[model samples]
Target: MLTSIQNPLVQKFRRLQNAKERRETQLFLLEGTHLIQEACAVNYPLMTVCYTSKWEEHHPELRSIVLENCDRVELVSDEVIKSIATTVNPDGIVAIAPRLAQKKPPIPAKLTIVLSTIQDPGNLGTIIRTAAAAGADGLWVSQDSVDLDNPKVLRASAGQWFRLAMGVSDNLHELVTSYQQQGVQIVSTTSHTQTSYWDVNLTKPTLILLGNEGAGLSDDLAALADLQVKIPMETGVESLNVATAAALMLYEVRRQRS
Candidate 1:
């Protein structure tokens, strides 16, 4: 068993924790049996898996599956697993998987989610999970947003990240403009807007634009939107959390299309 944290393989896995290394190697660490299983189930390319003996004993079926599908499986000490894991208490398994390629599929007839400058990884991940659950066609994030591959983001997504088509764009305005050219309506959310979100015709091909946690959509992007709407709130409550707001908006689109 690999007992030392300095083992070459363990070092490689540890290096994957850094954003720059992840970008350079095109690899990231996925901890916990569920996340690793989700990746393997989707046939996402897995480079290596490290697990402790106790983990293998408790999850023999999963161990066999990992051994069968993965090219490399190392039996490591629990300490080694802990060293490589980002969580306070890991589930005794971690896998190294290649980063997902950014995809820009043809905009679907359904609603798309446009995220601008969303800095919180948990928020971004929860939004992604919500988007996938709501059957969003795709998701686009501005370049300034949190890294979709951030470990917290991955964990918050609850494996739904694998099921979604997502892309990052340096120019959100241009991206939204192109969608508009293709006859998709841009819907921006703001408190000052008089239009209620429910009033918008979401049955049409639409892109729902949500902005940063602190600042809402930039004025330029809001101005470019075909419609600006707001969710009606009780007095003294200004707004909802971005992810909650996204879920409400996306499901409303689904309700309309149904």
Candidate 2:
């Protein structure tokens, strides 16, 4: 039973909570008994596991995974576990998970979701989760987008990242161009465009581009969109959250395709 709160392992966890440290180290903290179990279930390659005194008793699956496959396990005090988490409730356990390489797009001809420089980890994770749910062929994570392994992203995604085929690339334009050549229509969401999203034909091949929350779309990406579209909104609101916009566009496309 590790009683001290100032252990070296605890300090490392504390450091990784910072955005700068996470970026520098390319690692994020995942806190939750089930999340740890999910990672092990998917063979996500756990580097370290830290938990309070009762972790093993509380979660047999986690204990089994840790004892059988994990490289290291550090037992710490409940107070120590709380110090390293970003959430209000720490769940008495946390793990340092290595960032897995995202899979490349499987079928370039199918519906593709392209996210450009989306800085919010929560939005990016939610988009990925939505993409997985919407049955998109694959997803693109632009270089400027938030770190996929960031704790907030992992928590928001709810383990969807393990199943979806995703890629981190800087050449979204090139991919869009290639898909276009193959008869795929690239649709970019924009508040400026007048075309109703439903009217567009999404039954054919498509690539949907979502831009930053404040900035709708980059000029280059927007130029590539075969048709720029807008989700008709009530008068009070000018636009939707980028994730919301993407979800709306994805739903419209799916509705038309069916």
Candidate 2, 49-75: lDDT as tens digits: 888777667887668777777778878
- What stretches of model 2 exceed 4 Å from their correct place? none
| lDDT values for all models | 0.88, 0.81
Q: Count clashing pairs, candidate 1.
A: 0
Q: After superposition, how far is residue 220 of candidate 2 from its true place, in Å?
A: 1.9
Cα TM-score of candidate 2: 0.91
* Candidate 2 total steric clashes: 0
- Clash count per candidate: 0, 0
lDDT of 2 at 75: 80
In the range 1-258, model 1's lDDT, one tens digit per residue, is: 999998889999899889889989888888888788788788777779999998999999888888888889999998999999999999899989877675664564457999999999999999999998999888999999998898999999999888888999999889888889889999988888789999979988999999999888898888888988899999999779999999999999988888
